[model samples]
Target chain A: MKFDDKIPIYYQIKNYIYRQIIVGELAPGDKLPAVRQLAVNLTVNVNTVQRALGELISEKIIEPQRGKGNFVTEDQGTIEKLKKLLITQQLQELYENLHQLNVTDTEIVSYLQDYIAKRKQVQ
Target chain B: MTNTIEIKNLNYRKNYRSILEDVNLTIESGKTVGLLGENGAGKTTLMRLIAGVAKGASGKITVANQDGVPEKKSVISFSEQLNGFSSNMRIDKIIRFYEDVYPDFSTKKYNEMAGFLQIDEGLRLSALSRGMKEKLVIGLTLSRDTKVYLLDEPFGGIDSMTRKKIIQSIIKWKSDDAVILVSDHYVSEIASILDEVVIIKDRTIYTQKSAEEIRSKYAEGIEQYYESIYEGNDIDD
Candidate 1:
């Protein structure tokens, strides 16, 4: 629930949860923090936290139960699929941006693989 | 959900002096909106219009979409700026009055919030300081679980630390489905919690938009943006 002014709060929250899911920090079926508690911790409006949670629930990454709270979806296969879809979307965006800059196909492949290697090294 | 507040082409005047003209505003479903204006800028007049506290002003105001804006019902709670509070009432008695009035009131929640706010439940209203009174108002208003909660100058006359505490209390109490309209001259204090900033100036709705958008467009903080707007328009010389 930490708020950074540089990004839209909901997107920041979504990315935080997504990173947790990717790194196995937040396991499947784990119950996340409540909106009010998160807001109090982060010093942000509950509405901002609510919007982020609502988006996560709508994406099927989390399931919300009345009077119980929100829980991480327990479908590993679906999680993997969503991960693949998101990666594809990111790659497509990068590819388009590279094409707009008129980088050659071979250059693009080399640059991409090099960047991926650097990312893996850092991780 | 019923409309919490709706004002249609509202025109208000005091002895041939226009207070608000052609003011069309609505506080609908689920957003907490911050109403911002300087002194004598008609924020209270608008609140009174919606609360049915003032009449003979030509306008249409619908609180909870009730016919003629019912007498400040439980659905809409208007906490005025430094009024409607009696020094003789004890904190416990006030809590009881609220519990008896609001069908959706939660005494348990009220006591919990009061405890969290460090309010002495046994103290009389006169014994408490200004900051404590503000905190008590917030605790009471938020415990109602109402559709519309309109707070006027919630951050005024309090120390910085107490103001931060009150703001946190507001964030904790508000639900996703409720609409909170807060008006204050202390715009910078509550700027972070504001989803939308509506400026009432010169008897009209001057500007209304998200704080981020306003900052980006004006390339300045909200306080500076407001100052620039009024400064340019207030050239008497």
Candidate 2:
């Protein structure tokens, strides 16, 4: 995957995996690829991949099976929480950007609603 | 034992001219480090010192915990070794030569890399293009089961496709816990794969920073940060 050079690579790696999970590309309880395989696939350092997986393991989003490999957490609640967290982070960025443009919070909401309506009409 | 490279108080002078002075750097296992510097910034000289090919530097250089030149040379694979081979020799013959000289050279790994790199072992070194030669050099370097790998500008003068292939081969073949130090003047080509970057300037190590730290702290790409270092100093001192 192409990466933005301005962001920490491990952070981008974590987000890539999170995106796969949120999109159901990786189902709960599904085994993740071996760390070396992931590193090769991403064209990143194996240590960087390990760092990203380490954070995921700590967050309980992934479970480590001794001598086997890593797997996505089976808890549907945890997956849901992860999805909500991603959405909130993205919305926060959008909100802050609009605020910088001198748009009030109420106007930001209205503008987002209008934008969605226009997009739906085009679809 | 962990594979590591440690250099202390290293200095190199030739014919009363100092090439490098007080160079100190330590690289732990499992890192893919980028050695960044302008041409003649002592990047190649430093790698030569680490690989034990160049002598007369009054400092301690150790690789895989061994300080002796022969011991250090045994565990390190330097790309410059290919220069010693005859251009009339076929690719397969060179591989055999490597096997005979370096007990650590693995024919099996060489074959795998050869196939992955699409190198024709039957072709003489003179028949290969620049990109092909580089691919062969990289294949030969990585085919060794060594603790440290020093790649000096493997991507220089190569096309983008060849560059991408080399990058892929590096990622695919790098053994865990074995450090690879790749030196290149251009940063963006190999930035993503690097764990840390060591910038050499003015005959010494200017700075060494983790790649992620540069990204997160400076909010800039490795190439940008490297370029910023020489912004106003375009004229040589």
Candidate 3:
């Protein structure tokens, strides 16, 4: 939960929760801790925590239960979409960094092939 | 939402020296604001004005939708200087004093805070360490069910463990309709917990900004932003 100073903390918190979901640490339909508990655990402003949760609720990634706390969405389709979105985002960052290093699209394809080959050798 | 605390055209002059001049700021409810400045930057003076403690402050100040009258003081809880109390007073005695005087004071909350801070009821004011005194003061300040809480340097020279406890206390007890304004010289420690930051410099309200906005806009933390300002750099936001 250590946030980078450059990024908005709420956005970071949202991504942290998303990563947990994709990694299977936070299962769908699991109840989130109370906002106060999350704030204390992350050492962040309660308002910031609320903002992050607010976005999740709007995104339908989480939903609030009456008189109860929030819960991860049980929609398997949404979870799969989220997983794909995160992978795409990570590859975008990697692609941009490689392009900055003068890596062309063909070069990227070759790099991925070599990367897969190297991984198989290790296996 | 309307501002929970507002100060307009506030000026305080002490001994022919202007402490704070032409200050204007509005703090909304459900926010934790950090008041940051170097030594003699008038951080404490502004808090006192908001608390209605220090006098000769001329300007418009309001708390919890009421003008800065003695009645309005009920809604504001300023961190107490435990030094003003008798040295021999026990912790429980001090709690009793607050409960007896402030109708809004919550004994149950005080007990919970004291338990978290581990401040014994029998410890004398004189015998308490600096950190303990701060803990007691914080316990007393937060014990009040007030709309605004003004904390002045609660983390000054405090140990890391004690500071973490204080931070946790704030997060646990903060209300949605109340605003907590904490003034501190230690920026990094308080940066993460702040919703917004009000920077005071050169005898005026320098700038007030949301912490997240500052981070996303400048790619800098509140600490780095403060340093950049002191270095004569411009941050438009």
Candidate 4:
């Protein structure tokens, strides 16, 4: 769990948990580790972990059950939305970077197609 | 009482030489703060003052709402307290001494930390290497259930693996309501674990900012920011 010092740690922590959920490593309805456990595992401050979990709870990606700890949201629709949001965010970054390089909209689409074709053939 | 530390217009001098000047800082409970500065930048002096070990300061120092030195000493666990122990003393003897001297010292916590740190209580202090001695110091300091913990360069001269392990242990053993102030000149190793960073420069607190805020605002790591501040100044060392 090496972190990028240039980014907010809480934001990175959120992404880490989101990745686990998206990859099904944290299955639907699975209980998340306690805040202190996450802090120790990540070598981060407990308050930062708490802030990340608080945001997740507010976003409905995690549901806090009384006395049982936090669990991954059981709603499949919410998970799907989360996956879409992550893809959109990544694609936005790529698009913006290409735009800065003077890449046209049509050329960006062709470049993506070519990239995917090359990646698939390599796979 | 709230588990907070407050310093008002603090000043310390030794032999007509000023170590710290007009230092004022407040640390709230539930934070892991990094007290960062270069060597001889008064980082250790500041910690000693907060621990009530250093005297002759024209200022008010309060820990957990108590302004008296004895009260402050009781609530603070300082890493350098091991200096008073003889090197021939066994680790178990030191533990017993702590348990007898400090009512807040916990053998259960010490045992857990020692087992995790791979410390053999049967070994004498003189036999331990530098890294091993540092581990013992950290384990001993954190074994006390106190309001404030002052760890001065707990990672100095240790291997990265051992430093990482100690960081994990600190995170694991930290109580939610107690504040831990860790001082280090090197920032990268402990940057992620710090809630906020307080930098000492020119004999006073140069700046104190949230670690996340520094990352977000400067778009740089704490080490980089700290270096940038000293870029133009003629650093003595």
Highest TM-score model number: 4
Q: Which runs of model 1 end up more than 4 angstroms from their true locations?
A: A1-7, A15-29, A54-123, B69-72, B100-105, B211-228, B231-237
Model-by-model DockQ, in order: 0.21, 0.77, 0.75, 0.89
lDDT of 2 by residue, B1-237 (tens): 354988999999999999999999989898899999999999999999999899999988989999998888889999999999888999889988999999999999989988988998899999999999999999999999999999999999999889888998998899988899999998898998999999999899988889999898888899998898766433122
- All candidates' lDDT scores? 0.77, 0.92, 0.89, 0.92
The order of the candidates by lDDT, greatest first, is 4, 2, 3, 1
- What's the ranking of the predictions by TM-score, best on top? 4, 2, 3, 1
lDDT of 2 at A79: 100
Q: How close is candidate 3 to the true structure, as a TM-score?
A: 0.94
Q: Which digits, one per residue and each the tens of the lDDT, describe model 1 over residues B93-201?
A: 8888877777888888888888878888699989988899888888887887777888888777899888888888888877777888889877777766776778898
**Candidate 4 residue-wise lDDT, B135-186, digit = tens:** 9999999999998999999999999989998999999998998899999989
Residue-level error in angstroms, candidate 1, position B231: 4.4
TM-scores of the models, in the order given: 0.73, 0.95, 0.94, 0.96
- In candidate 3, chain A reaches a TM of 0.92
Which residue pairs in candidate 4 collide?
A: none
lDDT of 2 at B18: 100
Q: Which digits, one per residue and each the tens of the lDDT, describe model 3 over residues B35-144?
A: 99998899988888887888788889988878846867888888954557999988888888898989999999999999999997898889988788888989999989
**Candidate 3 residue-wise lDDT at B178:** 84
